[model samples]
Target: MGSAREALLDAAYEAIVAGDWTGARMADLAARAGVSRQTLYNEFGNRDQLVAALVLREAERFRALTGQAAREAPGDVGDATAAAVTAALTAALDNPLIKATLTDDTSGLLPYLTTRSAAIMDVFREDSIAIFTERWPEPAEHPEVRAEVGWISETAFRLVISHLIVATEPVETTSRHIAEVVRRLMRDLTTT
Candidate 1:
């Protein structure tokens, strides 16, 4: 069952990479995966479900890559965040799903990253909170620290999303700017 599901996802990814996701029929996807149409439907329910699965998979991949980059970077949490953001932006530059979504405004896939991004953003938010909490633990008598951490996470994640949607500067430059902002915020929190 898992193999069939993976095959279906693989087939869908291939279609997207080939620039045919908008035109690819369920039957064609099932044929590519060597599965029946019923099997595909049973696995994913519909095209939107399949797309959600694909986007979630990509989000997990992003999380892993960014987590590793953060862990391996030198200096403080801000430095780690910069490395993670840089890794994500660099990956986005060549990521087929991102490319397809950005280049084809009519594909109807933009919602998965924008208005309908709760599921994806939830994953990123949880991960960011974990990373930040570990780096800056809550102090005794400071219950508001958690809220501050959440705000930082949301702000940083939104910045990355905005860049992905509307890139104005180079990846490294934007990444560094984000890091500096985060660093200032953290410094203020520490001093206050």
Candidate 2:
């Protein structure tokens, strides 16, 4: 049963990446998964639930990658944090799933991205903080440091997303600006 569920999810994810989500129906998803529509509902409840699951799954993957990058980043805490941000933001934007979600007008995924959802925001923050704590492990034990890092991470991520969706400038340039801000923030925080 679990295997079947996983298979369904894998197929659904592939369909999403392939741009099928734009006009994808439950029947299409089930057929692609080699499962019954009933099975899909049993596993994922409904289309909205399925979409939410996909978003959360991608978020987790991004978090893991960011955590690894944070651990491996070079230089001081500031440089390391900036590197992690670059890695995580680049990965998120480059991800096929996210690209589809953000760009596929037919998928209705933009609403999820644009709307304020506490559940989604919690996932984002938790995942971001996980990577951040790994980079600044000591900060994890300090409330003030944790709060500061959280603020920085959220701000940096928002800037990256804004650039991706709204800015005319290239991502690399926007990324550099974000990194510089993070570097400055880290320097100030660490110095004082």
Candidate 3:
């Protein structure tokens, strides 16, 4: 049953990544997962919920990857924090699902990505904050450090999304700028 659900989610995600979100009908998703439409509906409730679930799943994956990067990066807390932030942002922008969400303006995916919802921003914030706390352990005990980590993480995501969706700059340049911004933010946080 879990495998069936995961299969459905994977199908839906592939549809979205392929710029076929509009074509990702419930019947097609069910067929792709080798389940009936009734089963898909029973499992996911509706298309919006499915989309939210897919995005949330991807966000969690991104958080995990970022946490791993933080753990592996050899540096002080400040450098590790910056490296994690950069890695996460770069990975997100490079992800086919995320790129489709942010770049395909013809689709509603971008709006969905930024929309405020119980399953979207709220879940992302909670997960990311927890990951940041774990990654930057030095800041976990300090209110100031905690606040700075939260601010930097959120700001970095926002900047990256904006750059990808609205700005005309090349991706490499934007990524570099974001990395620098994160590094400076972390340096300041460590010093103050």
> Model 1 reaches what TM-score against the true structure?
0.92
Q: What tens digits encode model 1's per-residue C-alpha lDDT throughout 138-179?
A: 422366766777678778888998999999999999999998
Best to worst by lDDT, what's the order?
1, 3, 2
Runs off by more than 4 Å, candidate 2: 92-94, 116-121, 130-145, 186-192
TM-score of 3: 0.73
Q: What would the per-residue lDDT of candidate 2 be over residues 41-71, giving only the tens digit for each residue?
A: 9989998888777777766676667656666
Best by lDDT: 1
For residue 168, give model 3's deviation from the true position in Å: 5.8
Kindly indicate the candidate among 1 and 2 with the higher TM-score. 1
Give the clash total for candidate 1.
Answer: 0
Report the C-alpha displacement of residue 173, candidate 2, in angstroms: 3.3
Q: What local distance difference test score does each model get?
A: 0.85, 0.70, 0.70
TM-score of each: 0.92, 0.77, 0.73
Give per-residue lDDT, candidate 3, residue 46: 94
lDDT, model 2, position 16: 79
After superposition, the stretches of candidate 3 with alpha carbons farther than 4 Å from their true spots are 117-149, 166-192
